[model samples]
Target: MGNAQDKPPGTGGGGGRSDQATAGSGARGRAGGSAEKAQTHKASEKRVANGRENSPAGGQGQQGSPAVDTSYLDAPSGALPPHLARLKNEGNHLFKHGQFGDALEKYTHAIDGCAEAGIDSPEDLCILYSNRAACYLKDGNSTDCIQDCTKALELQPYSLKALLRRAIAYESLERYRKAYVDYKTVLQIDTGVQAAHDSVHRITKMLIEQDGPGWRENLPDIPAVPLSVQQHHREKPISVEVAQARAARAAQEEVRKKEACFTLLKREGNDLVKKGHFQEALQKYNECLSLKSDECALYTNRAICFLKLNHFEEAKQDCDSALQLEPSNKKAFYRRALAYKGLQDYLSASSDLQEVLQLDPNVREAEQELEVVTGLLRQSLMDSSAHTPRV
Candidate 1:
């Protein structure tokens, strides 16, 4: 979520002098000074009522300029096709007033207008899907975001925006191999697209460092921008279901072909973790951890596996590691305490059991363990005290 408090310069969301700026959806009718008639409009007259230049991003401009430019009264956005533009302009007006959810409705209205106007081509609809996808992403609808990106890709298989967005969705869904492939493709499409190239390099290096398999190496080389597919005859766009399958398969196949890029791969080690292999539900949890070791739950999960395998030391170590990462983790404390008890380290077991009680006093299990450990510790202490010389 590269979203800062405000839009960055040159992104065109708000602020700065970039002709090519990105206008986020959600600009519509809101109360303000007159946006039409007798207004003294000049070239570069800063018609940025709700304009990106005059947007919140650029709102905090040069301090010397005293009175804020209160010229126009609408949000800033790219020019739409005619009548639709006017409608969006009104929406921008509302958006500038910080009416987000409402403004979104207006933006949808504009899209509907475009659709009604018979301007529904792959290229045209792709742009629409991209814009809508941005909206859904902002609203935190992962499913919708994926759907829109898929639709956009169907229109323009090589849409850079779609590829980047799809990669983001994959990353969120813990599909790293797919993200890597998308980044690689983005680089090929535009050799100068450094960000994509850098992401691919970094993630790939990380996987390799973890002894991740060769599937990553053998991943299909995709460009930063997709090559133009011959549009000999126009056809209706593919459905959302097809698009999703394509995205999943594209990512799944990439990983399936070679070594697994997930921690489950480490556990399975080229045996069951190979291509087209079905991973159980826990496999997802393991894969997530391999990409990032800081998650507490993953450690607990692995500890469970160790416990099942009767690897008491390994289980204790994982519990300790998890506790180190997140001190207040009750589950880690409880599990580690159990692991210590299993290893017959009564002192360490008692200590962890006590801490678990402190964190969650209602745990009947921890209480029972505490009762049992306390008697053992006290008896041991008594024996030791008896042996000590009266110094």
Candidate 2:
């Protein structure tokens, strides 16, 4: 697929939400603070095994184009002190070799080198801070990463690196307003910073035109999010804390509709099962499981797939898991009995059906099955009695 940046124009409608998502491994509950998930056509383990470089969002990094706003924060065409020059060369070398770890160390030394040498001008400090911020980002220390970028902004207000990195950080935090402000700042720095320009334009369109809850109290009337970023955000799970926070925000705004992405995913899995794509259906069901383990339907559906695949042991295990997560799931009990039956473990199956009837006395299938088993057990007892004759 083309890079997100290379995509043809899309109507920048709505605040960024997307339908497409990657599902992987067993789905976890949507506890909601910045939890990211993906779609799964392939098993997560298989997908990871076929992988390359790591990114924060758990995908391949996009190649970054040259910053158009580079001119916005260059040191004023003057000679740099010798130590600063040497530090710059060393840092650049490490960064170029993809040695982000060592490069990070070098940048830290460079920052210390500047302080010891009294090279603390705002413009110079801003550049140092920005370079170091990149190192922190490469390390996945986004909290510190954004702080450094903010420091760069304090020094060089128009610094594109600072603006963009701050936006990146805010997005990582799911703080759309602050991110939008930083993006907007890029435009004021220069209109030619087309990536930021394009990003700002796109984000604005998404917030205002593309998705709901697009407005922010912090910035000028910019749309505030990229279409692709919004699309990525859609269906993405957050830690419980973050989801609650976002829920609070939307509730106050009275904007977003009822949340059902997990339910939606589970429903899709059900549809897949109906088409007899057992493995594929399990993937979808497992994806839902990852989002909300408490979701009774996810476990039941996945167990159904296991049963269809004739993996009775696995089906029973899935039922056990589902019932633990949702004790009231009658379907789990019904299926657990069937799994036992498939394994010819009639006693266990009878116990399960007994539980099913307890949960739903009107279930005719459970009643009929229970009666049949009971009759067989009685006949066996009578036959054994006859065989023990005179003993």
Candidate 3:
């Protein structure tokens, strides 16, 4: 998460400064010192607590010197709404004290307060969500961290902090492609950012090692920030609250359309598979997966095509991804069994087939596969034993 340690500065936490100079000087100036003088001296011995300095510095100035001013105790935060400011202040306090859970709760309350007041400025929302993303990262909830950063980006796409946080979360999840894209976008927006530049180089090297040098050539383009929305805000200048609400709805609708296209692509992939066009089906499934990586059915279907093409390793990887998304998916287990069988891994094949059967005892395909694998294992063991010399 982008510099998650940079929390909003705490406010209203500085207690009133003690009148140090006056008290200390009076104690030192006392004459005929006795029990009362000693008691006064003891009472006057004070040090500013919590790192707060006594405002009016030094003792009452010499007769002709100018008086020290300590009137700026209530620091002005320049027109920030009181409720929102208070929430951030409290959240920052909790965050500094390692109370991340409580800090998140305070940040959430601030978000709700903004909504209730119809204050939906992307700038305001982005800060709140980004701060909350920091808390989620601290709590080791990278998924939620990504979600909050995404929300912040939807409001303010050019927010480098939000983009950086999202990239960090994606990297944590091993989604290297997504993280690389985000880092690239950050570099595009601000070429001077060393972190983004370093991240791009690091992730590029990793991608090369994982997928070979050609991987960079196939990477998707970095996404452009929607600065036009911010510009339009200035030009047309609708009520901020109304504009923010409208923007949110429009973004949601766009997401719905994207999901609909994802479903359509999946259906097309299924049709291609049915027609025995395994290569075309693979392409379609890949496209669907690009839009919805968490779809267990899509991954399983892709594994089916890989198996048809005799790409046992690729088929196993796809089945593994599907099972990661859905551990209970019998189809994934069965498909993986096929993959293992293709690779002549009778032991693993038998295990997966057994799991499939356990999940669905009525599955005839799994039952038959399990029997075949069991016999192969037994025959292989017997062959090995037959070749062994007596000891």
Candidate 4:
């Protein structure tokens, strides 16, 4: 975001000499005429000097005459015209000095020159627009900033600077949604931009509050970042500290996404359980456990699904796991008791039910179930004794 101005290529020039002595004599003779006549003579002499400088035959000429400054007549190969390049360089200098207004004028002049001269170099034009956009942003003219940035982007779609500038402009204008999209897109292009990461995080909360859970559906289409842009970013040089920070931020973002996914799956599992869709709930819980295997709630929640599905062994296993994580969980104890009863293990059922009561004595359901289980146990023992042979 600093400066955001484009640097112009270096200018070069060839030397030439002009016979200004003759022009000077003529000007002296015409001094009695209108000032316009003398001015025209001076301009003609300057043009002659420029023409001689550009001529292939022109070199150090007639021994004693002073050389004319013909540097303005030449531009670097494959660069913008000297006049336009000068404007751009001036703009960059002005921008660095915090003269944004003057910089804006210079960029505008360069852009106009490009149009007049039919200089259709997209890269050059894009830079001019982007530099001007920087000026607009500095001046707090966000609307103009957006417009210039858009123009720059149109000329060079993958312009990182223009995209960042436009995103800042959008945020300043309170167009949070667009700003968010641009910031996300910027990260896709170059993940090292901490500002984009921060802005995305800030805007995401605002959007979620404004549009509810379906906020993403209301956003504009975010274009996929090109692979070339990614490669370019990778090849770009960065400081060691910046690289380390970027990697750390990337890891944190990954964990945040994983946790968010886990929460969503857990919620969906709970909802499915409430709706009596035990199998679907089981699938959801399975995914949640994959993401967070040590979560006791996930095991307990899955145990309910297994119990509802009459998978007594699986239910008992899940309950056992939950208890291993939380020994005093009344729900785990009660659910395990139910699972044992389903397996026709009355003794184990009775033991788990008693444990549940020990943990939470006010659980009336456990008290009733324990009473029934104890009576069954007593009857089974008496019947066994009555039927016993000579052992």
Candidate 5:
């Protein structure tokens, strides 16, 4: 009974072991096939989603597949996704190298990704739009540039770069009035932007020629910059060189304005003098002098006003100031002579007339006045001697 139960060891036991090994191998083979099929399906889906299936190189082997960018997958949580950041950086790099078309594509991809990701960050969106607008501008697509710039402005109002780019686009489109308004708004936001200042001037000339004196009325109302934006610009750090340049430009602008005001006032004063409105002319001259205190011509012109008004002392003082500024000013010498005559100082008047003649012998008025003053001085001296008692 024991020998029957044991069987032959090699025949039964060895055969049993062999059958178990075969079964286990088959199970593993089937599982491996399923895993390989799943992997192939996943790779196919990725290629389809990336739109590479129909690409010219897609028919090639795996080596022809587009390089996968898995950098975003390793991004740390709670920060801007690595993919978006990478796109922006690559766009900037391309733009710096003057590959505007390529940069534009990069920015477009990033913008679309942001939209799909539901990113609503105003500052980030604004920068992307503005950058795209710059690319459009470079491509000579004014319409698209304006649209992108407008979108940027809407996202971040008072954006200086957006306003400037939009203004340029509008000008390129021959929308002069809108361009003028946008440039003006840019200046209000940042007076230091020389490009904005120049654009405003150029557009103003175009608008004036197009719409005449009513150009301003035809312009769209300019929006006021928010206080927050103004404060932000004011508080922003600037390099030393930039700060110096800005200060120099501001000083030059101030000088230009003052000179213009001085010219206008001086012209008005001269007109009033021609009309014999001496008092009003004197007021205008005073304003002119206030604007240009060191101007020798201003002092001489004001002295004429004083003389016409019969303010002899004031006229004399103005002539004195004019002479101090220009020692050989013929106008000052002649005017001072008239002032002395008005004050009944015949001796001083005669001496000033001689000085005027010495400066310019062709001054007929001075020659005539000298004769009259000489006669008065001689008569006064004789009268004084006649009134003197014997000593």
Candidate 6:
């Protein structure tokens, strides 16, 4: 089998029997480790008993010691053992080479071995299931993908990869409501994750497309979010007026640092835009927005990237955000009008172009766009009239 470097994304193995237990021991099956140690202790005690019987003391302490149970000693520790590790490595190799069926077979063999050995570490099981889910997804078997990811999440509820994969599977099945819910879960787990945020935004639109305006109401009630993940973001409770003043000062300083960071990100995005790397530029803009969510210029910059990428809906959305921040922004109006034109919403395009003209009559680009949009609107009206029944 190949090394970890050879494994692809979503299929890489982490902890094994050889690896030390992580800080979150429960997740890593510490109980199973303790069971293994207890078995070893029993074996050592048996050796001592034999030694005592052979010695001149003649097992003096044997009568006083209570009998130890060895009933639970049959199973090995729950971590991935060497035999199963070989199977996983083979599977990862096959998966990397596009042999999903062969990879899945190896993974299945490993799973069967775990059951036989009573190795039921949730973390290990979750990794195997997620890797199998990745195979299912690659094979375009959305049903199997969903099943595998569901199994993975059952073992480890906060498995972000499993949730994301399941969301994608739901989307493939056209179960937009379920997809939206899963993506929302990912966002709640980590709000700073740009991909999760984008997935949530995209799936919400998909839900609306399938279920209309009140699509959110059709979704299942979201479970109460676990507070464990949010602990990092909570500030220390403050009561003293002087301490409050110091905290306010620190908050102001943080805001200044964030602004400085945003400026650097915006410059990077602009550079990427100039180099015709619209996708990379969009990523920069997304990171910038995460830092300063309400910055109108960030939205405007991102809208330009979306426009260049031909993602008119996303472009329109960014433009809307920009306009909400500053309605008088000419760039926002102009970019939105371009997106509307791209979407063939000629009336909206024309209206936005008129706004651009009102904002600056001498803007030749706006004037030209208005002419083109007006012609399209007139043509659309004529076509509609021709299709209508005579009154």
**Which digits, one per residue and each the tens of the lDDT, describe model 5 over residues 237-311?**
975666787798889999999999999999999999899998999999899988889999888888998898889
Residue 301, model 2: Cα distance from true site in angstroms: 1.9
lDDT of each: 0.57, 0.60, 0.70, 0.75, 0.72, 0.70
The weakest ten consecutive residues by lDDT in model 1 span 1-10
RMSD of each: 17.9, 20.9, 22.2, 17.9, 24.6, 24.2
Question: Over the stretch 1-391, how does candidate 1's per-residue lDDT look in tens digits?
Answer: 1210121111222211122122223221111123331132211123333342343333335655555543433333344464455445544444555544434444455555555465555775565566555544444444555666787888888776677766655555545677688766655555545556666776677567654677556555654442343232123375465467568867877776433556554455234333424334236546766676786777886776666566789889889889899988988888888788778777988999889889989999999988887787788788889999997
Q: Could you say which candidate leads in TM-score?
A: 5
Worst 10 residues of 2 by lDDT: 23-32
Task: Report model 3's TM-score to 2 decimal places.
Answer: 0.41
Segments in model 5 whose C-alpha atoms lie over 4 Å from true places: 1-192, 197-246
TM-score of each: 0.35, 0.37, 0.41, 0.45, 0.47, 0.41
The prediction achieving the highest lDDT against the true structure is 4
Per-residue alpha-carbon lDDT of model 4 for 1-391, expressed as tens digits? 2634232111111111122332122122223344554354345335433445222222335556666554543434235876567556656656766777656755665676576567989988888888888877776666667787898899889788899888887877678788888888889998767788877898899889999999999899898988987898788787565667778888999999999999999999999999999999999999999999999999889999999999999999999999999999888999999899889788999999989888888999999999888888888888889999975
Q: Give me the overall lDDT of model 2.
A: 0.60
Q: Tens digit of lDDT per residue, candidate 3, span 331-389?
A: 99999999999998999999999898888899998888898999998998899899999
**Residue-wise C-alpha lDDT for candidate 2, range 1-391, written one tens digit per residue:** 0011221222121221122132100111111122232122123323323432133222445568332221211223224464454444445555655655544544554455455456657876677667766655555555655777877878766566677776766655555566677777666554444566666666676566534563654445644444444444444564465567667776855533323666677778888888998999988877777667676667778889999999999999889988998887889999998888788777788888999999889999999988876766577667879899694
Task: Name the candidate, 5 or 6, with the larger lDDT value.
Answer: 5
User: How many residue pairs in model 2 have overlapping backbones?
Assistant: 30
Worst 10 residues of 5 by lDDT: 1-10
For model 5, the local distance difference test gives: 0.72
Give lDDT tens digits, candidate 6, residues 1-391: 1111122223422222233222111132223345554454344335433433221211234565765432222234247886566556656656766776656655655565566589868988888878877766766566666777898889988777788787777776667677778878877775644556766787777667878998878997665558784453234343365366567778998999998998999999999999999999999999998888998998988999999999999999999999999999999999999999999999999999999889999889999989999999999999999999998
- Best-first order by TM-score: 5, 4, 6, 3, 2, 1
Give one clash count per candidate, in the order shown.
28, 30, 0, 0, 0, 0
